[model samples]
Target chain A: MISIHNLTKQFGRLRALDGIEAEFSAGQSIALIGPNGSGKTTLLKCLLGMARPDNGTLQFEGSDLTRSDTYRARIGYMPQIGRYPDNMRIGQLFDMMRDLRGYPENVDEELLDEFGLKAMFDKPLRALSGGTRQKVSAALAFLFRPAVLILDEPTAGLDPLAAEVLKAKILRERNTDRVIIVTSHILSDLDEISTHVLYLMDGKLQFFKDIETLKTETGESRLGLAIANVMRRHANENQASA
Target chain B: MLAKYSSTAAATLPFTGEPDGVTCAEKKARPVAAMLKIAKYVLYDILRNRIVLGYAAFLFVAALTFFNLEGDGSKSLMSLLNIVLIVAPLVSVIFSTIHFYNSYEFIELLVAQPVSRRTILGAEYAGVGGALVAAFLFGIGLPVAVFAPDARGFTLLVVGVLLTLVFVSLAFLAAVLTRDKARGIGLALLLWFCFSILYDGLVLVLLFAFSDYPLEKPTLVLTFLNPVDLSRILMLLQLDVSALMGYTGAVFNEFLGSTLGVALAYGCLALWVLLPMIWAERVFRKKDL
Candidate 1:
């Protein structure tokens, strides 16, 4: 579980994350939805400690994440754009990660086998296609069997079958004591896996609700339509009030 | 509790194999072991790069040629000294600056890992610096050892190693100062030029203006300000050129004759390496990756 209190981040003139407050508990798969430049990625980066907050506290299980780095050991992150040493082989990258973590027992190589990644372990990362690289990132995220998984656009570059494979894995972990936060522009892709919805627009939290409640409230069963309905209602109210 | 994430029966579901007890010991070794591993990987990766490989080959060929042409051990040391004073530092600084720029993604990847900022930055410094040193050791050291086996050979080798470390540290400082690779590289080149060329020119101007006064001590202090000039002075001391036995030469010889002076010179070189590196590490720690 993670808790954030009034988090703020600024990049020169742009306020990337503006006093955002939220909490994420285990046993729920969260769909983080937002438009372009909505500060979704920035918020995720703050959670991973890649982007330091300008003001406020971010805590994991009652302890501040900024206080120490040991907290990251519990979270497996799949970056939106995976950038590795181009010269290194796929196998070596995995091997190096395993060496760094030294948690061989915790590594789940099921994705590697499922995606046929183990067969091309000898290939250099630079030489691999983008889809293959995404597979590598996905496999590494689940490799350590961490209690939390923070995936940014988890299936963005994957083929249909690969994307479906990842979605199934995510859904299977939905009822377990694991927190999976996924950010994706593809609403249909996330609807299958996400149980809870956290909508962000322009660095502010629009709402956080269970999937069924969100659908019922908006009179729309699909996530895409339900979210659009909320946005339209807010826009009309603002226009009429103005 | 453990089977909370599993879909299958608790007893049959496949997951992490190790029980919880063994992880405690593994966790303790994580930081140090991880840093060393990163450094090792970096070193190996750099040594294989075409540019570094070319640099090593260039050194070997140049050292071999100079030794063969000079024929005398002392003469070869003098020529090799000039080469090391300029080339070693230039290559180390430039290569490191470019390497850091090219590997921006690599740093991002590591930042997302379960490692501290201190560990990541520290490992980078160690990795790049150590690899450059190893390249110099084999590329230039082997030839110097073969050509000049005396104390002069060892002295030249030490100076070369120190110069490599100093400039590589400076490169890190340059890279950390700016986010833009072009600007960072420009800063690195500007720094290299100041120390390698402009510093000596300034020293000459000072010498000319103070020709009326005893400027030996001022000249010596000025030399310490630039690592390139300092290493050159170290080389001059090792060579002991008798033809330049003027007041300044006597001053240098008399001072360098003592053990304290040698230690002081080395301390200056060590400071050159440490100061920039410490500054870079501090900046890197606070940087938003």
Candidate 2:
């Protein structure tokens, strides 16, 4: 479980995360949905302690994640744009990560074999297409079965079948007690997978609730429409509060 | 309750196999392992890289040709080691510094993982240093080794490794201090210049200005700060040719007279490896990814 209290991240004069407070419980798959510059990435980075909040405390279970090894050990992060050393072969890259984590033999190598990655193991990562790179990232993310997984743009650049395979893995993983936090511009992807939604707007937490409730309240079944309606309503509510 | 407590403890702690009872004692080792991995990759990459390979081959051939043609083998070998001590560090500083800046995205990705910042810096520094050392050993050290395989040869190789680390540390510091690629590289080059070239120039100016005074002790004292000079002195001392360097040798011999003094000089050389490295580690820990 992760708890964020009074988190405020600023970049020079620009406010990135505006004193947002929220808690994400275990076994929950949460979608961090927002437009560009909505601070979705910033929030996730703060949680990972990759970005320092101007003022806030981020806790994993109970310990401060900002400066502790315990929190870092329990999580796996997949960046939106994963860049690898160009000359390294895919198998070599995996081996390097395995060495870094020191859990090579214990990790599940079945998915890698199943996805035909075993065949392309000797291929240079630079020569691989975007979809292949995405597969590699996905494989790295799921390899450790980490307690918590933070995936940024998880489905980006994937083929339809590959995307489905990843989505299925995510769903299956969630059936267990693992927590997943995902951010993406693809509404339908989150709609199909995310149990809860955290909608961010202009560096503010607009809402955090069950996806079903959001759809029901907005009178829209599709996630994109539901999110749009909620934003409109949130604006009107803010005006009334003002 | 005992069962529950045990289960929670088991869940929270993986048996580290290390005596520390920290599941991550091995995890801490991962940084060194990761660095080795990077070094291995750098070794392969640089070896296979047409440009680097070409440059290395060209230098090897040039050194061989020069040695074959040169009349004075000792003088030539000494000069070559001197050039390597000076230019090898410069190359290591520049190449490794540029590599760090160039691999920002790669580094950020590594930082996002469950890795300590010190591990990341160490791994990167080690990786770059390993590659440069290998290149130097093969490209230059091999020639020196062939020419002087005695204590002088062995010491030259040791000096090569030390010089590699000295420059690698400077590059690391430069990379940490400035985010701009050009400026970071410029700073590293400036550092190389100050240590390798300018500092000696300034020392020369001072010695000239106070020609009448006994400046030998102070001059010897000052050489400890510049790793290049320290390595050069160490090499010269080992070769027993301190007599040839004139006042510089007299100053070195007068102050660093004893075996303990020589050991202390090498100790300072080793500290050159530690000081910047410790500072770089601190900078990296607080650095924003």
Candidate 3:
């Protein structure tokens, strides 16, 4: 479980995360939804201990993640855009990452073969198409069976089939005492799997609640419409309070 | 229940094994493995990279041809050594600067991994230095080995490696300071040009301007601060060519050409390598990456 208290991060005059407090328990999947510059990425990095919070503490399973690296081995992160050495072959890159994490060489080669990457085994990453690169990124994220998986725009460049395959993978892992936090602009892609949604507005975590409750509260079946309705209500409430 | 459905779901997922097989402790921790993996790719990538190949080949052919046409074997050796000493550091600085700039994406990917920043920096330095040392060993080492065939040849190799480390350290300092690739490249090249050309020119101008006074000793003290000049003096002193190196070595000999003094000079050169590296690592530890 991840626990964040009074998390605040700022870059000069711009405050990215402002004294945010939240808890993410195991077996829970959260979809972080927000517009551009809403501090979604900043909050995720703080959880991963990749970014420093000026005025808060983040704890993973009662241990401080900021002070130690022990929590990292249990987590897997995939950035919005996967960056790799252009000179590395697909197979070589996977092997290297696997070795780094010290996971056994027994990776799920199903994705490698599904994408026909085996044929392009020796080809440098610079030659692969954007979709293929995303395939590699997705494979690396799920390969280790990490207890915590943090994916940023996990399906950005993927085709429908590959995207479905990745989403299915995230769902399967979440059922087995793992916590999955995904950030993406595509709400439908996450609709089936996201158990809870954390809405962010202007760098503030507006709310964290179950998806079913959100749908019932907003009276919308689709996640996109439900989110819009919630935002509209929040804006109206803010106006009344003001 | 989700338990029954979970098994069915697992089968359809990308990885189908039972999660029970591996716990976190069951897997070995190999932080350096990521770095080495990346380093291997860097080596193969740059080795096959046409631009690096062409640049190295051009330097080799140009150096050899110039030596062959312009002078005798000993004179050629001297000229070639001088050429590599001057050109090698600049090339190392430029090549490493470009490599670091170009690999920004890869750097980000590595950072996102459960890897330490130290391993990443170490691996990159090793990879870049390895590429350069390989080129130098072949480009300059082989020629000196065949021609000089003495302690001077071996010393030249050591000097080349030291020079490579120095520039690599400095380049890393530049790489860690800025995020803008163009600005980083510009600053790195400026550093190189300053060290290689402008600084020496400036020193010469100072010595010439202050010729009426005892500036030779003062200039020798100043030269010790630049690794290039120190390496050159060491090489010349090693070759017993101090006479040709002019009065700089005379002053250096008076001050540091003795056994203890040479040891101290080498110690100072080694410190130059360590100081920059230590600073780079400190900067990296606090960096946002």
Candidate 4:
């Protein structure tokens, strides 16, 4: 479980994440959605401790995120674009990650097998295509069977079939006692995987609601259409205020 | 079987289900070991790098050529000294800057892991610094030892090692200061140019501008400021080439020729290797990936 309160981050003149407050508990698959420069990535960076906040407290499992790195052991993160050492082989990369995580024996190799990555064990990371790299990122994110999984654009570069496989994997993981947070521009890809939709606009939290509630409130059956209606309403309100 | 057992074990745990069940104390004790693991991977990556290998090969061949050209061992050492002073630092700073920028995304990935920022940066420094030190040792130190195994030769090797480390630290500082790769590399090159070239010119202009003033103590202080110059002075003094350096050389000999002066010079060089790394680590800790 993660709790964020009044989180603020500034990049010179740009206030990337401003006064963000949210709570994510176990078994909740949150879809973090925002427009470009809406601070989605900044919030994720703050949660992961990659970027320090100007003001706020981030607590993981009731402990401050800044207190120690042991909290991160429970969080498995996959970057939007996975960049690995160019010279390292796929097997070596996985091995190195295992070694860093202290060689967890009960590793999840489902994604690895589903993506057929074991066959390309000797292939260097640089030689892999973007889709394959996405697969590797996906596999690594799930490898440790962590308590929390933060996946950024998990299905971006994946093919339709691979994306479906990943969506199915997310659905299966959702049944477990785990917390999953995902951010993607592809709303449809997140439609079935996410239970809650967290929308951000201009570094401000516009709404955080369950998908069913959002659908009912907006009177739209589809997640994408529902979000579009909300965004339109917000834009009209902003224009009227201006 | 192990996966099933671990899953059941995790479910039995009280509050949070840590699959691996790594305790807080175990986690705290693993930072050093984790840093070394990361360093090992980085070292392996760098070892397989064609450019670094080429750099090492270039030094080895160049040193061999110098020894072949100059039949006199000291003369060859002098030639190799120039190479070590200029080319070694240039290669080290540029290589380190480029490596840091290239590994930027990978570092972001690492940041999201359980390791602390301090461990990641320290591992990076150790990996890159260690690789370059190895390159210099095998490249230049090996040939020098083979040809001229004297005290002067050993001093050259020491100077080469220190300059490599100092430049690596400077390059890391430059890399952490700017997010852009081009700007970081440019800053690194500027640092190399300032210490290796411009600093000496500025010192010469100062010496000429105030020729009337007592300048020996000031010059000695100035020499400690640049690692490259300090190394050159150390090597030159060790070679006993003060006769060619005139009055200022004798003054340098009077000071640097003493035991305490040599110790102080080495101490300053060690500081050169440390201060920049510590400063860079501070910047990296608070840096936005």
lDDT of 3 by residue, B1-289 (tens): 1111111111112322222344443323333455576677677767877665665676677556755776434566677677767888888888898888887777777666655566677778888888887777777766566556777777777887888888888898898888788888888888878877788899988888888887776877787788888888777777677776577668777766678877877887888778887888778766665
Candidate 1 lDDT for residue B6: 16
TM-score for predicted model 1 compared with the true structure = 0.91
DockQ-superior candidate, 2 or 4: 4
Task: Say what the interface RMSD of candidate 1 is.
Answer: 9.9
RMSD, every candidate, angstroms: 5.4, 4.7, 6.6, 4.7
In model 3, the number of clashes is 0
Q: Kindly provide the TM-score of model 3 when superposed on the true structure, using C-alpha atoms.
A: 0.86
Report the C-alpha lDDT of model 2 over A99-200, residue by residue, as the tens digit.
Answer: 555544457564586578989989998898887888888888777667888899989998888888888888877855677999999999999889999988
lDDT tens digits by residue: candidate 4, B160-200:
99999999999999999999999999999999999999999
lDDT of 1 by residue, A44-96 (tens): 89998898899999988876776556556667899998888888999999988
Q: Which ten residues in a row have the lowest lDDT in candidate 2 chain B?
A: B1-10
After superposing candidate 4, which stretches have Cα over 4 Å from the reference? A239-242, B1-29
Candidate 1 shows a clash count of 0
Fraction of native contacts under 8 Å reproduced by each candidate: 0.43, 0.27, 0.28, 0.49
Q: Candidate 4's error at B13, in angstroms?
A: 11
Q: Clash pairs of candidate 4?
A: none
- The list of candidate 1 runs beyond 4 A from truth reads A240-242, B1-30, B210-214, B242-246
Q: What CAPRI-style quality would you assign to candidate 4?
A: acceptable
